[model samples]
Target chain A: MSTTVEMVRRPSSGAEQAPPSGALGRLRWAVVDGWVMTGRNMRHVIRSPEEIVLYFSLPIMFVLVFGYVFGSGMAVPGDGSYREFLLPGVFVMTMLYGLGATASQIAVDTGRGVVDRFRSLPMARSALLTGRAGADLLRALLELTVLVVCGLLVGWRWRNGVGDALAAVGLILLLRLAFTWLGILLGLLVPNPDTVSVIVFPFAFPLTALSNVFVAPELLPDWLGAIAAWNPLSATVAAARELFGNPGTGGESWAAQHALLLAVGWPVLLIAVLAPLAVRRYQRLSR
Target chain B: MTDETSAVVARGLRKTYGRTTALDGFDLTVPRGTVCGLLGPNGAGKTTALRVLTTLLRFDAGHARVAGHDVTRRPERVRAAIGLTGQYAAVDETLSGRQNLVLFGRLRHLPARMVRQRSDELLDQFGLTDVAGRSAATYSGGMRRRLDLAASLITTPEVLFLDEPTTGLDPRSRNGLWDAIRTLVTGGTTVLLTTQYLEEADQLADRISVVDAGRVVAEGTPAELKTRFGADRIELVVRHAGQLPAAAGLVERVTGGQVHVDRETRRLSAPVADRITALADLLRALQDASIAVEDVVLRRPTLDEAFLNITGHGASERTEVAA
Candidate 1:
């Protein structure tokens, strides 16, 4: 069992006082340290494919139910396919659900005291958030792939060329990245998984319901439609639809006309606002 | 090892959570390569002192240093030198035991090859080689605590902070952990362990600090603390249950101390000032009184009674309730 060898070769490396280096060195260390943690998180995802499948199934269910069951009643801009119109909306919904993925994982880690262990180490303080963001991005990409395949199987195709299709995919990923920060903020604020799940739904429901995710904003009352047009989720969905060359096209609203710019701007703003908020919450955890 | 050098030093540490104080003027000093047990009840601030020294929590007013690094001014240096195995086993349940160790090694900035080698050695040292590939969730309570301790030792930290590390382990596991800890201390690792278990402190600490109400009530070697509290006791169980009252009266008359008797067990026990004279007099008295004694013994004061005497309260009753 090599137990004797283990006893014989005990670590002789006494605490070699590592001097606090300059800011640049610390920043460099944070990147490498974060990448190492990202590898650990990826290993978890690979070992548990069932969890990944579960995450994918929920979004696929929404696509099937909304595209087939609710398709007949929903109005489209023209004779363009309703399945295609629902594709972008379903993808945005999937990202919204992905928000819970981060919250639940962080809550579990906090409850399990893994965060305390991480805090004790000499590694970068920001590595925890960076690692979580990296893994969540990977998960978001996987969810995007599965949803795209489901869309194709249901007769929803990206009519645009490969370049535009990639752009739309990028837009969806960007929105997911933005929500990841929100997930982190919520996770740090609420340490219970059940409470995080409960809180996420209320925010997610209103954000998705009030936007152009499931249906055209024109179908709502004028005031509600105006509000929906400016909702960040609406920008991403509209931009993705336009890029994918789907049924829905640009609308008269300024946000809808410049959907691509708004799509990029919204996530950037969300990241700017929530990233620091999450980091501050994390720093205050031990205090 | 110099007289002037202490692995961990804290003075006048103060901390509060809103209105309630977690630490108040708590002072401690542990010489290098020694195990200083912070013995206290549930809310007596043992954990708080450990947290402050480990750089996990900030103190409101105090000067604390870990491995010669001021915790508040040079926290990174303190963090680099210390290791902490908290009350709860801090490990990922989904990850395999070996994976958890490797991840921590990598985070400590160990070289890639060294990370793998050290992880293997730790797994083996903790007697987890066979189950290294298994998820930590599948491990027994003892195995999990060992893994947690192993993770903290990835870099051979100078000052290891153990905050109730054996709180929930079975007897066998607790002993195994204690052995592992002893080996580390022998290898020159300074340790600060906090525990509510008097037996744990008595068995492991070179010096024990009895903490109460966020401060140190008493500090001394285990033997010294026991001696300072009170003298040893003489206990006797009569051969016949009916002779209990007679034995109790005889013991009180001989020792001139309060005798406590259990009527059901026919057992009587009382404190004795001088061990040899008291034992001799008690035995001669029992014989003169024609009392048939089943058993007689003399024992020193336990850390439990000493702790109760010092703090005026028993240690946390959580473990007792669990038992």
Candidate 2:
């Protein structure tokens, strides 16, 4: 113990000087701190092999269940195969379910006092949240890559040109980015991490069921179809089907006809509204 | 006021949540390079005061300065100068111990080259070098706390805030933490510690501020606090319960203080000013009175008794529910 005390008595040789001043310096530090935090989160994902397996398995199971188990019984609105139509919906659905993961991770960090340490540090106030958004985006991209490969194995392909297919992938990621913000807000708002799944599942299930993920909105009843057509999830799925030239493109409703417009508009609107709310909630935590 | 001689100063800090007040008129001043202990039971606002000073939570009204910067207006400057280890160990459980320190160093704006070097140094100093590559989740409670403390020290802070650093640690680990804290103070770092253990405050703090119901009810050095409440006392147990009254009277006459008698225990006690002489005088008088004394001892008031005298309750009593 005396040796331990003697060791601690050594002077700290790497004491940091005060942070740089001025707006430019502050912005630079924000970016540096944000990147550091992002790396920290990425390490967690890499080290937890079991968590990665669990997260990826859900989307893979969904791909198998919807693509093969129900493909023969399901009907497509147009001439294309049902798996082609189902793949786009599955891609969009995976992004929507990702909201649960984002929320629970944030909640767990908050509960464990990690956020309190970050709040007390000299780092930029926006770094924690922006870092989370960055990490979630990267993880979402990985999920998309695996799902895309699985779709190919199940007889899904893009009839449209490569450029349109790439654009469709862009739209899917944009929706994911928006959902990331929503997850962050929900994570900060939840009282505990255990409750995030409870709230997220109830909310996400109804949303996916009401949208055109499993069936075209045109096949539903008049009122139910109108609600499904306008769902934010429907906008992204409908636009992706159009770009991929898959069957089950939505009917002539304004939301379906202008699928590309709504696809971009909905995510932009969600980011615009939810990002500020999440930031505000983070700033007021434990007040 | 941001004075050069003071590392921390708070005046009338007030914080409330809905109808509950967590801190009310909490005031403190800690001199530079000294340790000040905020001693209190649960729900006494010790953590709340720490949060306000560290700029983690806002107060409804108050003025506080840490390391010469206003806590509310110049929070970033305060944050740059201080480190906080919260009640819970805040290290990333998924990351290895070395990675946690490096992450905090980078976040604190240390040079990339220096970050790894500093982390290795900290891991060695904290006796965690042996397990530096293992994930923090696999570390024991004591190791995790040491890592948490090391993370806060990525750069030597001018002041450090430790909120109950040894709350759940075993006796050996608690002593190790105390020695580590002492080493930090010796190296010229001012520390503000909060704890529910009176002995911890007595052992490590240069001064202690006893808190109750969100305010500092008493403030002094450990010895001064004990003396302020009262001096040493002579307690004796009579051989027979029938002699308790006689023993009580004899103790009063010798000590010149009120004697408290307990018939059930056959014991009598009275405060004494001149401890040795009073003890000798009481013994001689009791012998002359033919009161059979089974046992006698002189004892000074513990901080627990002083706390009870000041707050009108024991130190372990929870006056209000709080986080």
Candidate 3:
């Protein structure tokens, strides 16, 4: 206890300087704060559970609308159950919708000056960003779990084994991690609360609905289908369809093989591209 | 700058947004352990300068050093040694008062145990122990300000920056904050405060620097600044508008300074020395002149007068300060 008191009397032992460059050091910090603040974020949700009820129900309503009302007309490229094929689309769709709420929370923080307070404090520079990303990833996981539970209630099932199902979950989370940075980037870009929905809604639909989340890309118009086929979300849904027992058949598209790679690649690439710029921008807000 | 103790030094800080310049070659020097007031009318670049010194905003040109460390080059070390409370109380509405302090303590890298102890100590010291467990959203404005100040002290920073810390506060709350600031200064913290209220600077600032349009218009102790631009003012209210002429002549004869007569109010005003004796003589002279006087008042120089003199009708205030 004396040692602890003595330690506080001296300078902070945290990253006063920049962190040492290595995978181990970076990942160590990423995981340490990743877990602590993730718990804290979850506790905030627990206390204000009503705040998320709207987010939880909205997408489930959309999935039901698409499955029962729109599924008969919509064509899938492969044969077999539409529920199996549609489930991956719904999973990917739910992940994309998570960005809207998360991004707006950041805008609220920005407006309330909480983001500025975080910047002024002498913490791990990356801790705030990493904690946010970690919590959003957790939110994505929870959202995925709920959508799956709802799917089960709706008589939806994946024919894959335990490992394959788990692999599909990993792939969906990987997709979420990539998109979370994109959400943070939007949050950083749009600093005002009133304009957040204006920014997130258009991007959410174009990125999610225009892709294979509900229908096969070939079913889209010639021009629209071309764009949808290359969207990274389309790749994720296609890859999930294959990994979760090929709800259609063991088919492959150019987007399927590379989309997951891009899904994994995008988050790292985004953190590389957007995180520093956003941190720098966040630092100089009133400047 | 003038052999001041120099706790903080800033030179040529500049920032521009589009076509307008917010700060232009601004320079400042603050002595250690003194409460320095950055007194300015609106749009005077006072907030810009404070933001740069606190390591929250970067300047396009020039430099600032806080507690002997360059803010630009060593922002982490600078941030470690400094605390800032903005004009608005930026308290998290979600957290309780104690939780707010503990959150800042943890962000400042205090251990869990120390965060707890220091948070309690601050709550007690700030007269907030009873309400510490309550959510800040439920707090009064004064309580939120106190908690915001408490959060800044979690690390016991050496240099504290307050930007209009008492704006919108009632008289009682303002004095309470003044007392807290004095206590901190006595404990060896250097404070740079910007305020629009002249009385606040008069009561609290060891020295006041009046900024106008991105420049320091005047910098000196309250006495020195007042003496440079002020004199003893004597006002006499005559019985009628016709008597203003008699009052003006009698005042001018004694003081030999210009007498300004308001015909509507039947009052005569002039600058002089030994204003009380002057008032006594003027009263006697008024009797001889048969000018029936109603009342008399001596107006001494206030920081308000000094502020008006230094920043007379500055248009930049439109952008710098808000009601």
Candidate 4:
């Protein structure tokens, strides 16, 4: 400690100076800085693979229990089997639950004072949020892969060709992206990770369970069915079913008929609303 | 680059959270390359003042400058020149010590090679080289704090803000931290420290500012503040327990200060002035009376007494402090 103090007291070389000068140069560094932050967050996930496994476990459990236990007497009123019909809903449910991960991560970061540390640096304002979003998107892709494999193991096959199947996976990820912004918004708004889980539970449980993911909205009471049909989760699930060429293809509702468009529209709309809200929440944090 | 010679300056900083006022018209100025101790109780606006200056928070009304840059208008410039180590460790627990340093170095835009070298240098300097590969979560409290301090120093910031940096450390760790802080100041890093521990302030600060009710109530050198607000104490421990009363009377007459006698310990204490003459007179009087004395000492008022005198209360007085 004393030697370092002496080293600092004397004039040192300017080796650790700022990277570059000018506005344009800073803008370039900002992009690179964001990538560095992304790598930092990704390293955490790598170090703790068990955490990722635990997060993935929930969706897998839901698939088996719902597929086997409920599949025995279940009917889809279409050519596709109930197991096939349940696959897309389970995927959507996984993505929906992923919103909590984003929220809790942000809450933990904020509570730990890492957010303040980042804010105090000369780095770009968007680096922290963008870095988190990047890691979460990668995580979402991993979960999607696991769920797809599990779906195959449980007799849920995608009859559609490569192009359509890829599109369905893309839609699921797009929904994840939308929910990621919502998570960021909630994370910034809440005080801690525990509170984030508490708040997210009420919304996630009802929204995922009532949507067309688990049961047809048409089977529910009239008002609830209308709500379920219009739910953003329902649109994504219906779209995934259509893309995978699964049976029970959203049965006769106008929402089912236009699944692909609504699936794309819901995420776009959510991003448009939640992304700015998240940014604003971040900016107004200590104000 | 700017005309301001002080490392930090804040004027009329006012911040409120609903009905509670965290900072109310607070003002401070810390000179360049000097340690400024912001001493106050738990609910005092010490942390709030730091947050505003570091650009981590926005005050409702204030004009603050750090490293000659306007904190609100030119925050990036201020941030570039300043580093803040908050009350919490503020480190990524999952990352190794070296990894945390590298992450901060990269964020500060240091060259990749420079970052690696700097991380190694800092880890060695802070005696963290052996554990640099381990996650910070595995570190002892002292080690985590050292790592946190290293993270803030990645770019050799012009001004460092340490808010209660040693709130929970043992005596050994606290001393280690104080040594590190002294080294930083010797190297010409201006520091603004806020701590509830009066000893920490006395050990670290060149100038001490007593903050209470969201503003500075008193500001001066530690010696000056102590002299102004504290009195010298004269203590006499008699060889015979029965001599306690006689010693107390002799000391009271010599010093003319309030005297407190503990008969069980046979100790007599009194606040005194003109320490040299008071001690001389008291000793001579006791000698003439043939009173046996085991110990005689004149002690200056402790920082705790000075703090309580200036703040009008102890640090434990948390009620209505935020208001």
Best-performing candidate as measured by TM-score: 2
Over B30-58, each residue of candidate 1 has an lDDT whose tens digit, in order, gives 99999999998887888888888888887
- Write down the C-alpha DockQ for each prediction: 0.43, 0.50, 0.29, 0.48
For model 2, how big is the CA root-mean-square deviation?
2.8
CA deviation > 4 Å runs, candidate 4: A1-30, A154-160, A215-225, A250-252, B1-3, B234-272, B277-296, B315-323
lDDT of each: 0.86, 0.88, 0.74, 0.86
Stretches > 4 Å off in candidate 3:
A1-44, A72-79, A218-226, A257-286, B1-5, B127-134, B237-244, B262-266, B273-297, B314-323
TM-score of chain A of 1: 0.93
Weakest 10 consecutive residues of candidate 1 chain A by summed lDDT: A1-10
Docking class of 2: medium
Per-residue lDDT tens digits for candidate 1, residues A1-287, read 12223335545444332544998888888898889878888888987989878988898899888998998788887668788899999998899888887998877876677788898888888888889888999988888888889988999888889999999989999999899999988998898988998889988999898998877887788889899999999999999999999977777789889999999999999999999999988888668
lDDT of 2 by residue, A1-287 (tens): 33344334333523665666899998898888888888988999999999899879989999999888987788878677888889999999999999898998888887788778888888998898888888988898899899989999998898899999999999999999999999999999995778996799989999999999888988889899999999999999999999998888958789989999999999999999999999999888747
lDDT of 3 by residue, B172-235 (tens): 8888888888877877788999988878888999988887777677899998888775677888
* Candidate 2 chain A: 10-residue stretch with minimal lDDT: A2-11
Off by over 4 Å in 2: A1-17, B1-4, B235-247, B261-268, B276-298
Clashing residue pairs in candidate 1 are: none
Q: Model 4, residue A256: what's the lDDT?
A: 69
Candidate whose DockQ is highest = 2
Candidate 2 displacement at residue A95 in angstroms = 0.3
Give the per-residue lDDT digits (tens) of candidate 4, residues A1-287.
33444373322323345535688877787788779888998999988889978988998999999999987777685556899999999998898899898999888887777778898888888888888888888888889899989999999898889999999999999999999999999998896899898899899998987888777777788888888888999999999988998876755678868989999999999999999999888888668
What C-alpha RMSD does candidate 1 show over the true interface residues after superposing them? 3.0
In the predicted model 2, the residue pairs found to clash are: none
User: Which of the two, 3 or 4, has more TM-score?
Assistant: 4
